[model samples]
Target: MNGAKVDVRKVAGEGVTWTLLATLYLRAWESRLPEPILGDRYAAGAVERIDYDFAALRRRIRPASNQFLVALRARQLDDWSRAFLARHPNAVVLQLGCGMDSRMLRLDPLGKLRWFDVDVPHVIELRRRIYPERGRYTMVGASVTDDGWLEAIPADRPVLVVAEGVLPYLTADEVRTLLARLTGHFTAGGELVFDASAPWVARVAEDFRWAPRDAREIERWIPGLTCADATPFTTHHRRIPVRRYRALYRLIHAVPALRNAYREFRFTF
Candidate 1:
């Protein structure tokens, strides 16, 4: 990975697309720390090269408050992805709403597994400018909700669908339809990993559309879907650098409802 040639502000602009930059910035900031969670050097390098109003964006989003938390979430997802690849070396991976995440780079060093990073056209274009194209790696420039993108991916192999900070932005119907399409298309059976907020959190965050109190609730929406694991950030509260945030997470983890309010979930079908 090298420095970005295009200006992210001109490409991604604001709104949902801009959130990708925020995450990239957070990962880069975390990587600079003495002890980092994700240790994404590619993200740090991209951040340094991309020309954008990062300071203004930071002030607007106030992303620093959840900096470590963001890195933790990414690290957890990466771990799950690595485990999936370890078990099924030839599995196909679909990284939905990939943004500018370097997950494929981090996990697929040997380029053994087929990997596809799915996102909108503009984001994909930006990614092209930043990252080098490699064998067994393809960038799909299409919305996750779009059906056409799936046609290009091979359905013969088991699929591992990974979505981080994506499902919340999609409507419940959209998510259900997308999952149904995926499960129906891939008969080999695979896993789905993503994070979701609680209903109350969704209500508070006006932009978010879908929230499930329980991961198993998804099984009702899509037949054959089983909740394998649901873990809250508080599960690793000890890793938090700030004492106050650690204490807060501890309290949140104590309550079943609160703990599940915001967490990552793994589902198998």
Candidate 2:
């Protein structure tokens, strides 16, 4: 809720979940900027409520450019989501690996559609404390790769599956299996939107487990899953404010592989 505050020091100590705090912090930081890309006030509020070592995390992450990129990525995803929901008001939205993201609040599609935020248990518990209860919005505490959770969600309506900052962390096989399961479950057919890193970026980012050279490569992984769009982050590099960061993005854009080193992809099944 809007005015709720909780100590999240223990949750912040977990290894994988720790990354959520960094993302939450970045969104909050960017929201405070004079002209923000994602202006997520809910994120700013959540950051304010959660008591953690954000100062130390900020120092470690050195979030100058990261803050911009994170907000921009979120803004892009939000735009796509809004477009999808507008087209199908009765759609069901599944946000996998949702973490502490305030997308449901930011979108505020209450009563307009069904929304589910799925993540691991501890993260979900933290989210329960931070976010207010809303009609037609559910929080499922299960890993995205888990098959059992899908059985509970209604599949009769159009579905929009979103997995931002999640797929690359999954093994190639896991990514393939997850997408297949999602498409299989939602027989009515819907869209899937998510961002991914290129192979080179994955190689350098030791934590990432899978990265595709081409976004369309996923078409081979799942039959009937066609890539609708693949937009490189560098395509919007001019939006970055800092001169050096913008220059870095321009340099990346000049190189073919690096151009899509990080990009967003949309697919319809």
Candidate 3:
């Protein structure tokens, strides 16, 4: 198969695929920046594999600090995953809502670590075709809410679950149900890292007022789950390559309400 050509039909979607493209664009944009916070080599490669007019789409969108924010979140998430991998070399890493990004490949969780990327069937099908798979890395085609898919992972090793930019789309009840199943399945206890929006942000952005009010709101839903750490969107603002944007983010962070606007949480069970 030609490396430059990908089936346009497969990548067509208004939800996950668009988000995936946005993430890839952020990585590509960051890589070209004077001083990139996260130099994701795989992102450029991923973007090439998808058949779309990325430049046109990117230009059409508002040129805000979105790319900066996206890169910051990815850096933070990748850092957390790396930290976990360093501590638990043989951990089971589950990437829920795994889209077009090559996180498993980028992280390179080599050796005893078992890595699984699970998402809806269509996305998984496209991902499997685009991304390379190996003995340690596997792709599952199932919704994260399904219980049967959880059985495919070994029960022996501790699991490190990552769901980047996923939880907000789900209803609060759905999020709680998924967490309950995960905690129940991983009785040995492990870390679950994911992002969530504040109630105000959700209301304004999605016209949904049910976003978690705080990190504690998430911990309360799952038994024996403690939010080990929570970092707001501006936590890694200093990492932004542009000086003015970095200063603006610092100012935003100083505001109490805006500081807690959107946060990523790391939970330990």
TM-score of each: 0.93, 0.93, 0.92
Encode model 1's per-residue lDDT on 3-111: one tens digit a residue: 3456775755553377888899888887876767788988988887788888898887665566777887888888888898889988999999988899988998777
Q: How accurate is candidate 3 locally (lDDT)?
A: 0.79
Encode model 2's per-residue lDDT on 1-269: one tens digit a residue.
45545778565335446788889889988888776778888888888888777889999877777887788788888888889888888899999999899998888645456889998888888888888658889999998888799999889989999898989889999999999899999998889999999888898996899998786689987877999888887777787767898899889889877777789888988
Query: Residue-wise lDDT of candidate 3 within 75-178, one digit each (tens)?
Result: 88889989998898878999998887677877873535689988888787778767868888899989887769998887677889999887787777878888
Query: In candidate 1, where is summed lDDT lowest over 10 consecutive residues?
Result: 9-18
TM-score of 1: 0.93
Could you tell which candidate, 1 or 3, scores higher by TM-score?
1
Clashes of 2: 0
Number of clashing pairs per prediction, in order: 0, 0, 0
lDDT of each: 0.84, 0.84, 0.79
By summed lDDT, the worst window of 10 consecutive residues in model 3 runs over 8-17
Alpha-carbon deviation at 242 in model 2, angstroms: 3.9
